[model samples]
Target: MGAGRRPSGRCLHTGGIVMKVSYREALKMALREALSNDPRVFLMGEDVGRYGGCYAVSKGLIDEFGEERIRDTPLSESGFVGAGIGAALGGMRPIVEVMTVNFSLLCLDQIVNTAATLRHMSGGQFSVPLVVRMTTGAGRQLAAQHSHSLENYYAHVPGIRVVAPATLEDARGMLATALENPDPVIMFEHNALYNMEGELDETAGAVDIDRAAIRRSGEQVSLITFGGNLQKTLAAAEQLSTEGISAEVVDLRTLRPLDDDTIMASVRKTHRAVIISEEWRSGSLAAEVGMRIAEQAFYDLDAPLARVCSAE
Candidate 1:
């Protein structure tokens, strides 16, 4: 149940406790586990109850946790998000699920101004132990409005911690970690990754939400990305390997408190870097990564920094 080590066991064939599940299932499992472990943890969102979530991630949770814990709110994003903040402030840990990042704009004031800033403004008198989960990115062709990868917008703000769980382990582990955090945490899940299936260690529980992780190791180039762009970047890295290129892939799991050390170390080893983001080129997280590399790892670069981002 520790965050640092993956659980080991005997498989059915070999007697190990490994289970294969979709990314969506892993996320549901995490939520189910959080609710079962903490009575204060309740899930609130549109279509999260009888509708079983916008993406069906909470299909059977309502029956197990009951209606009080699995709350179904109206279409008012601002109202519910603010209520979640208030609930967190009052001693309840609320997991607010905004259907999409596009809709989160309706509650920017509640999230950035209230949930994020209360502790600092109150001189540490209050903290928002809240978790907001939403789908982000542009793979479903849901048109311009529904497909924005705007986790960067939240990441740019102060007082809030932003995390993107791009892999199965992270999807299963990070929510539990975020629930334990004293501050508000916004978790952005890529729209296209929900159905992605992979083997998950059944014992995977919590994970540290403070650092970045190197998903793939290499020495020729560093491909740094987070959230929706992680899988695409890893795929591109694999393609490059066929051409004899050694590309390293770094997943910036925690976005707000960017892990500068992990990123700088990757740049030092590779000497070249390419930052990618699902967001547009302007004011994107990839831009921040590029600038940080320029500022701290400038001497380590063997070539000019490259960026792969959406073209506006």
Candidate 2:
């Protein structure tokens, strides 16, 4: 695996070891690799440096990389986020961490206005190679303010790419790919998945952030979802299997650029579909995905499209 606390200078890949770790640990590994591999990469956000990250994902990074690389800023999302975008403009790869999706709204202008549109607005002469990461979805006792799945809000924007990493491998590796992209990328890490444990191959590295993955294969209904809801959907699929219903589970890793190909393909095979989202049903990513299936794979369905989504 990653041998030391600070595996310095171009050590992003690993091999030949299977280790069990929590989602939180996997993310730390990814951060370690990114900061170590690239001189241009640095992290800045509230509580990320001295406080060891809001969720403890960046716990040991400050000690490993120092405050300069693991910067801790004041509680102004818009200000610090704007600073990150400026760093990107100056040819520095910056990772801005907003504590939660609810707080990310405070920096909407910086993300949607500056970082997102810079490349196009500059007639392709410049690019904001920035990555903004924030925890999304609800956790116990956090209430409505700190707990919201606002993937659709960012997904609606055209210039930036949005990705929600569900599995352990994605949690560990997607950061690498997002950092590599020239345009701004928003990574929504589900609040509930931080402590979830699973086996991750040591060789895991940057994964494709552009496509959907089929978690399970079945001939009946297709259960499509992303982020924290994925585990619940997989459990639901297992229950359905017991009732003799073969449900195929589709993990929509990249939400914004919805993988219509994998989604439609699953619907075509299963001949039925159900989309699950933690976000409210109105204007949710589920609604967008369902509409696409209706337009492209409507004829192949054996039953009406269904959705299990948030009510509020």
Candidate 3:
């Protein structure tokens, strides 16, 4: 069985049961499960309820949960998103869906200034148990306006957990974890991965929202990335392997409480690092990681850190 799948022997068979689901389907299931399990949980965004979401990830949910719980807000990103933060503060768990990360910029004030700062500013008196979901990345050639990976922007903020659900397991588990967090949480789903199907294990546990995960092990060079760049990094790793350079791939699943120890440990073992990101190189997350490597792992390095970031 693949890493994402449970063994066939472990499968439950009450009377010959068989079913399959895609990554997108798994995400819907997670959302539906959250709604069914908790009345406090509700979804709000443009086209989310009646239109079935931009990618159809929320399809059929409106009928099941009704319009109140599964709401379709107006096209105003800042207005509706800010409203979500307010709703969360009012003791409701709102899963605010931004059509895309690029559009999320219009509501940066709410996300960074409001949702992220509420808990700390209130001295823990208030908690923003909110989840903001947005599609990110630039593979479909949607041009600049529609295509941008803004996970780094969110990751740079404090008091908010930034997550990228790269696999089927993460797609299924991240929603519940995000809701459980007392602070705000942002989940970036790569636009390119919505239809990429993978098997989902029934017993998969909640992935740590604060730790980096090593997706592949190697000994020569380290390829560190998250979100949509992960697949590119892995492909680069494989190509480098053929050239006699084994590349270890590290997926920084959660960018806010960055698992720097895991990243540094990998760098210590490999002695070389290559940070990859879909964001532009200048002032990008890759640049931040490179700076950290130089600061902490300067003495342990075999060579200067390298980076492969998107072109402006």
Candidate 4:
């Protein structure tokens, strides 16, 4: 019988301890840093100002930066998103929050059609250096509409970068990297991770938004996942370890440029894989990852790939 699973503890390096922050606080700090460091950077979203923020991640920002920088808009997602694109084109770095992934669909045209295609359509003459942040994943039982995982939709789009921060370090560093990029970037912050607490390793700053991270090392199987499912997948890995199955946990931090090297390396090493995701199995990010593994590491795999996904 499988033993009870002990949750995997967060990694906190204390060699040169600076400070620790909750996931939300880390995000706030990142936002503050971006706003302070760059006069061009501004945060705009629904209730992001007076109301603190949809998730309070932008809390206290308005006080420091004022309403001009921490602007709040109406319920119109498309209108605001389009405005963000225009703002970015006007030489401003805008961080637009869409409340949640469910609402982001209202601005699909702006995100997919305009923000993504501008640089290419203009033959590199125009660049949309914009960053869009939104909450994703379920767990709070916000019902059908509010609770859904739609990261795969954004990852599927071309000319835009998609990233998910599953740890404190990423939460603190990803935004800075996104702000510097010339292309549009979509950042998905798992709704359930807002309250997560961990120490930010001060040694690491401005992490690359183009690589996958190996959360845990193992030999028997590879457990690949991202966003909200990371902690749960790590816990599951610990459970498998008790049964003599050494499972490696790989966090696909950046979904768009899916780090083939890191993913293939793990798959080739473990020889077996299990992809975990909160999205439905059909056409999910997990499915794409599995396909990539099969295409590149088929000969390295000793067993068929597996996926643990949401129920249909």
lDDT for residue 252 in candidate 1, whole number 0-100: 93
Residue 123 alpha-carbon offset, candidate 1, angstroms: 0.4
Better of 3 and 4 by TM-score: 4
**Can you tell me which runs of candidate 4 are displaced by over 4 Å?**
1-14, 202-204
Error of model 1, residue 55, in angstroms:
0.6
Score each candidate by Cα lDDT: 0.90, 0.91, 0.85, 0.90
- What does candidate 3 score on TM? 0.92
Please list the residue runs of candidate 3 whose C-alpha ends up more than 4 Å from where it truly belongs after superposition: 1-20
lDDT of model 2, residue 6: 30
Residues 1-312, candidate 4: write the lDDT tens digits. Answer: 011111133354556644556788778878888998999999999999988897888877788889999999999999999999999999999999999899999999999999999999999999999999999888576778888899999999999999999998999899999999999999999989999976665454688999999999999999999999999999999999999989999999999989999999999899999999999999999999999999999999999999999999
What lDDT is reached at residue 163 by model 1? 96
Task: At residue 144, give the lDDT of candidate 2.
Answer: 83
- lDDT per residue as tens, model 3, 9-110: 333455343334566777887888889889999999999988889988888888888999999998999999899999999999999999999999999999
The pairs that clash in candidate 2 are none
Q: Supply the TM-score for candidate 2.
A: 0.95
Which residue pairs collide, candidate 1?
9-16, 10-15, 10-16, 11-14, 11-15, 11-16
Q: Tell me model 1's lDDT, rounded to 2 decimals.
A: 0.90
